[model samples]
Target: MSSKFLFAALGLGFMLASCGNQKSEYDRFYEQDYKDSVSEAVANAPEPAPGTRTPSAPAQQQPAQEVHPGSKLIAGSDCTACHSNQQKLVGPAYVEVAAKYEENDKNREYLIGKILEGGAGVWGQVPMPPHPNLNKDDAGKMVDYILSLNN
Candidate 1:
């Protein structure tokens, strides 16, 4: 048994030793050439002037107001089964959710996904159910509605 184990160990070691120390395809960033290229790109990148928005930044936060399209969609959907604008039911209140998240398109995109796909832990142990039937446009409208309540 010991002889067989030793043979297996030696064979494994030989296989590993024969393999070169080349980086895997997924580890491209770890390569020295890739690192140098990334550094060069960053150094050459243009800077934004004062008060200008960066390309990667989200759109400006809109003033808190009623998003009517989103409101109507929410009224039609099953969201009212657990959520409301002012207070908690089976899930966190819309106001609480509004307060907890930032008011921006990125946050809106995230909440849209959360609304359609469902998520847990942002509020508590209660899990949200997935709305597979919901369209992204309507989901986004729901997000818009939620963000409008951020007062």
Candidate 2:
């Protein structure tokens, strides 16, 4: 083959190979579109404001003094084993629990029973075994601390 013809063929081969390896503009556009869809879905979802309860039910304001006493008991107990203030550990974070229950007084009572009698499937797949050792007062305190996280 002539040198010029050979060089032209080599250049064409290189161009084809590069085009084959590169992502198509359509592929890039779709990937970006998927990401934007997910971001928009999340942004449009309702998010509770900090220190405000979820709007499932209207929450009556409890006196801070009454909540403080129970919170102290919760801090002294074993509720901290599975629950933390900020993040999920063995179980969902106390902050998350508080956020879910904050709107309903009935939720507080129901959670108190769960604490004493242990339950499953409330937060996730993990089962939170009952803590029968905790008395009513202590359990009430833990619930208070859980609620206090909203503050």
Candidate 3:
């Protein structure tokens, strides 16, 4: 009888302990305190001139970053895992790709198809996975950005 009671207690304790660390919907990275702080800051801040930046506001409020438009797509996608601009990663460097193929109409069109369909045995054995949902125009933008990295 004592052994059975011990087993039940241990099981109950384990369940409670596991539940202690579980996060609910309200448990967000940006909590009420963070929202209050941002609201207070915005309320007090003086608006700057149309093109100018405010000195007291956060650094993120400064001039927009000089990153390419395709950079956002690259950041959200798995492209970073295999390709980097200046140096070799899992695949050839973007600069090397730019060197191999000029960014003219021919290469741009070809690369768009490659990016959408995926390719293997072209840049060695590591296969480039297909991005079926990525449209041709966006793929062209990414190709443009990669080609632009030749400098």
Which candidate wins on lDDT?
1
Reference-based lDDT, each prediction: 0.72, 0.66, 0.70
Clashes of 3: 0
Error of 3 at 37 (Å): 36
TM-score of 2: 0.50
Q: Which stretches of candidate 1 lie over 4 Å from their true place?
A: 1-67
| Candidate 2 ranges beyond 4 A from true positions | 1-67
Q: Which of the two candidates, 1 or 2, achieves a greater lDDT against the reference?
A: 1
On residues 28-102, what C-alpha lDDT tens digit does candidate 1 reach at each position? 433544445445655555565433335443233333363378877886898877877776878888899889898
User: Every model's Cα RMSD, please?
Assistant: 19.8, 17.5, 17.7
Question: What is the full ranking by TM-score, best candidate first?
Answer: 3, 1, 2
TM-score of each: 0.54, 0.50, 0.56
| lDDT score at residue 28, model 3, on the 0-100 scale | 38
Tens digit per residue, CA lDDT, model 2, 1-151: 2344444455445445555456788756655555555555555655554433344422342455654666556546765566656768778887888778764678778988988998888778888888888887778777776777776
lDDT of 3 at 138: 88
Please give the lDDT score for candidate 1.
0.72
